[model samples]
Target: MCAKNILWIMCDQLRFDYLSCAGHPYLQTPNIDALANRGVRFSRAYVQSPICGPSRMSFYTGRYVRSHGSTWNGVPLRVGEPTLGDHLSEIGVRTALIGKTHMRADTEGMARLGIDPESLIGVQVAQCGFEPYERDDGLHPDGPYAPDPAYDDYLRDRGFGGSNPWEQWANSAQGEDGDILSGWLLAHADKPARVPEAHSETAYMTNRAMAFIREAKADGRPWCAHLSYIKPHWPYIVPAPYHDMYGANQVVPVVRSGREKENPHPLYASYMEERFSRVFARPGVRERVIPAYMGLIRQIDDHVGRLAAFLEEEGLTDSTMIVFTSDHGDYLGDHWLGEKELFHEVSVKIPLIVVDPSRDADATRGTVTDALVEAIDLAPTFLDAFGGKAKPHVLEGRSLLPLLRGSPDWTRRAVISEYDYSQRRARVDHDVPVADCRMTMVFDGRWKLVHVEGMRPMLYDLESDPEEFVDLGDDPACEAERARLLGLMFAWARNPANRITMSEEQIAAAYDTELDANILIGYWDEAEVDAARKARGDAE
Candidate 1:
């Protein structure tokens, strides 16, 4: 089978139920919902990690965070790790990245190996094996670690008229005093963004992606475009019409109450005490921010419609595979917590929709499955779609092509997610050591277990209390189930950790032993040597 074009769209911090297809009460999201209707939507898709950097690293490499060692944002993905781009390239598929990768280059690793950090090969190795069309990690000009210089430069060229145009024109808003209110300040969530809709980051990125598609199509090559958008992530503000699209009535009642604070688990109690988490619980905060959040999502949906229309108009719809998902989900105050990093459905459960235009996939069109899926499965799915052979030693994830085509059997029973808050330096300001500040979430449909390194375990009976209000970890009746789940986790942890996938020369050299090379002198003489060389396809 020949490889086809693949469009992998990742929206940042989008919640699972915020779309009409996902049962949002007020949000229509017709464009995004239309994809779900025409494709197979997995109801219980979970990310490998509930945080951005680690989760995306897992998605690109098709490996677990434990395996990749990039446990948080700003941590380097180990040099030489194979990614989706690398695997797709093996099948002659041209892979290009158009937006945020959250990749922190492995400078130390490159320097240690005497590799140039700015070289062509080094750039590809640093950016998760992707050939960059345009790389933006969504950091503003004055961002702490690194500024998105490209975005800032683009904004300035468009006559934004500000010293820091990225923050001033694109992300800030006019206050009651007619002063600029920066979106980075959480207090300005309800304000309208100062930038016009046409010049916004979302619009700019969509056009960039469209441009790449046009150029790649003209090259007459099979390609995959990673269209990653950073929005609804934070700074919760939108431009003009979107900012006023919804208001207080549109805000759904929060999923939590004061009851969760009563005798909360150690981790839960710690998170609730956080300033970010506490601020969301303040009166009027939810009402003020949800409108902008909804607006950001609305904008993403509209852009998705534009991309889909471009595919159809250019006659590329049937020749491309469209997969839409998020790196992780936003809590949106679901469990009295502000951000993602938990095992709760609100934080970990993401929306996954796959549209395979092949005739084999027609049987499952518009179907929704409750099957367990993970973000890591994306790489192997693209590999299968591109007719590439997945390397078992490299890719820990299994392909979803079988499941997407309506096969009755499943490849995974329990899905896993993990988080290491230790490296989240600012967030982990307490005296806790980094060694013991990690957590793993292992869940099947009926039960969920949160295994912490140095903290008490948390178990939730999803069948009985799906909202996870009660912790069954200490309950005597759940002891056997907990043991079973613990054993499964332990078993997974025992797997081999070898990273080397031997090269073709290494395989050939293994058979070119001294005895094999000297075999011509054995019994039959030089006559058999020529026959052996011909058989091995190395004949003169």
Candidate 2:
């Protein structure tokens, strides 16, 4: 009744609607679609944060960004925060990382506690509690950012010689004049990457995952392989064949309008004026960039087919749970935005397909649910699949196993996401203080409200404006709805997120035993104390 292994596959910046199963008009992801046909696909899954580091930290820790305090990129997850690896490993599962987690070590926290970084406990804390088969964040530019030595060695061994082979060979493209074109420039997006298809980053990560699986099988240990891929993200140039698989004609319609910019929210207008947004809003930017983005996704699908086939060949398919998701979705010019920093559907919503091979999951196979799921839910789901109960005081997310097994009692009223933009240019442009550069979005099934610090809250009636074109933030007509959502946000913010040391049951038990411990402050007489003891069956 429990899965012997878990294969957690997470892609970088993949949108919810990009797969064939998810209603993409032109792009086809047959392998991912097949996975969906074999399991449950959540149609409305949102991450706790839209940014990479905070969102991934939420996914790893099963807690909100505010609770984890890793609110932005390069911010370290505090040393003692329990992650997926930490929880799974406690139950005798080997947790291994094959690729990116975007986790920085809280070295200061460790040093303050006098924990040696080279020690076993410190190593686990530094690596986000996963044994690194290979930990590569996948961005290996020259100069300040050092290339991943292992990936660089792999590239060089394959005869791609350069100071930074990952940047020069894997991410760059050859121009018409045979000049090396950096993938950093959006102009070269339509061209194929200089590296061969097999030597690409996606392929390398896939091979590493398979290698880890094979080793785990030989060792005969139940393992959770976090096969995280770093593609379909930036530097969006795929290898040949895949590069030109989709033309400019295949690109979906841009989901923005001039009306959105007419009287945008102050924060939204500031984001629209940012360089990336302005560049994406240009005449032919999306046409050039989106096809390559689609191509990268197609390549990932192909690799997924390869991985699934490998699992079956190794006789692990029937015992392993395959989970496919992403850190967050990309904006790609939606709402005049180039990146994922806002509360738009295109940015916060991500693809989540779970292929549980257990017999209990068969009834829900090939079904799509409109359940309100969050990124934090995955950690508890994995633990639940392994017959482990989620620690309610520690994990904020409920397990998805009941939903997977067709339990009817599963119900959720709202989902919440947070954003901290203190380090962003918008904060500086608006002259906002660091403490005031935060936003919280609370969405019921029909209405979405964003509470921005030091500003008017943004509201959208998704039932009326599914595209979120109209801002009802300052509209007096929607005052009642806005107030209701504000109340919900306030209640959510008031939750006791830090009360992790004791569960409600434990607290209740402690209260019940307080009088038994003879600390009776309200006792007026000895007869009353005797009656209380007799009632509690503690009379002597």
Candidate 3:
């Protein structure tokens, strides 16, 4: 029961119901499902944001999106923000990231504040606070067009000769005309990845993770390795057997129809008409892409099994807490949306499986819970699992230790997620100004509400309509419930720490010792200033 080791495995854009244990009809992800069987599968887990970078920042920092202020992908997480790596590292646990973090360093902040961008602290802040065992943010050779030389060097050392093998092989397919089909293009979604299965990014990252686990285990030091996989994300293509594993026949029926567009919610309708959403909704397009997406997930499941096997082989399974989750879920044409930006369940809800190798979790093994868990809860959970407490002044998330120990009820009744698309140039097709273009989601297990700035909220009764086709926001019968859910959303979003690091309590404590420096305007007249200073503790 001395398991202080944490193995956090995350897959990018994995859905909540894609595993067999989660009632997925098409995908038989037995490896991930087996972990669920041995642990607790949270049926209603959600992310703080429906995008990658912000969601992961929430996860790693145990802070809500507003508190951390890394609102979107490529948005720099503010410097000096505490993260799980910072907390765990202070407690003698080595923290490392093996795969993608989608983090961008705050160069502007660093330069403006005169902080050294090349310092160890600066790099840690830029990498979502994880030390690099083998840092690979999944963009290599060519992606989001970032320059990545680490994986490129690995490729060269392994005899994969090319200036950008990522584009040439890993993400490309060999066409019959000897042309290269770029996975970045939807035209090549059906093509198998030109990279050999062993050299695929997923495989290489998994190997790096295994090596890290082995190295850390040898030293017997407590460690948390974030074995993040980048696949099942985009460029929807896979290598070898996984590439041809499932086709359109294996894909679940499209969760949309002309009916959605008929009475579309203004925001929802606008998203459907966008170029990306339009392509996903187009006929034959999904048939070509979805299988590749599923294939990438299937490969991830295999790797999960491989890691589990490695743990058992090394006799570390008994002393390591394994938690599997995703930053967020992909829309994959759900509700006629292409990617995850909206507040749909397909974008915000994700699978959360936790295996706590402790006596307290024995009875809960293989049980499913409907607790409203957020991505931000992860860092606090890990901290609590290791018998450490979160710095109340730093982390804004509640720990899931009670749930892990089989608590019947939860402190939180609803989960919240949000997205700010104001900076993106994508057309909203709405009369609202771009600055006010944002979205938020609140799911209370039964009732779910989506609120968009400058627009009427979208509401759904999930108990009756789990797939969320019906919008009851303006429905007279649901008015009361809508008000209640919106109240919860408002209260949750009203945290004084939003766009702030210090909590009110923390601020009060810090100022409590500064009463001698208390100088106030308008609190007292100038004639009474001397008397006020004498009455207070500030008198010289």
Clashes of 2: 0
Report the lDDT tens digits of candidate 3 across residue range 221-267: 89999988887888788998888889889888888766667777877
| C-alpha lDDT (0 to 100) for residue 316 of candidate 3 | 88
Over 222-312, each residue of candidate 2 has an lDDT whose tens digit, in order, gives 9999998988889878899898999999888989888898878989999998888888999999999999999999999999999999999
Ranking by TM-score: 2, 1, 3
Query: Judged by TM-score relative to the true structure, which candidate is superior, 2 or 3?
Result: 2
Computed on alpha carbons, the lDDT of every model, listed in order, comes to 0.84, 0.91, 0.82
Candidate No. with top lDDT: 2
Please write out the lDDT profile of model 1 over residues 139-194, one tens digit for every residue.
56655334655777787787876777778877889987889998987678777898
Worst 10 residues of 1 by lDDT: 423-432
- Candidate 1's TM-score: 0.92
Write the number of the candidate with greater TM-score, choosing between 1 and 2.
Answer: 2
For each candidate, what TM-score against the reference?
0.92, 0.96, 0.91
Off by over 4 Å in 3: 142-146, 423-428, 498-540
What C-alpha root-mean-square deviation, in Å, does candidate 2 show against the real structure?
A: 2.0
Q: Which stretches of candidate 2 lie over 4 Å from their true place?
A: 141-147, 514-535, 538-540
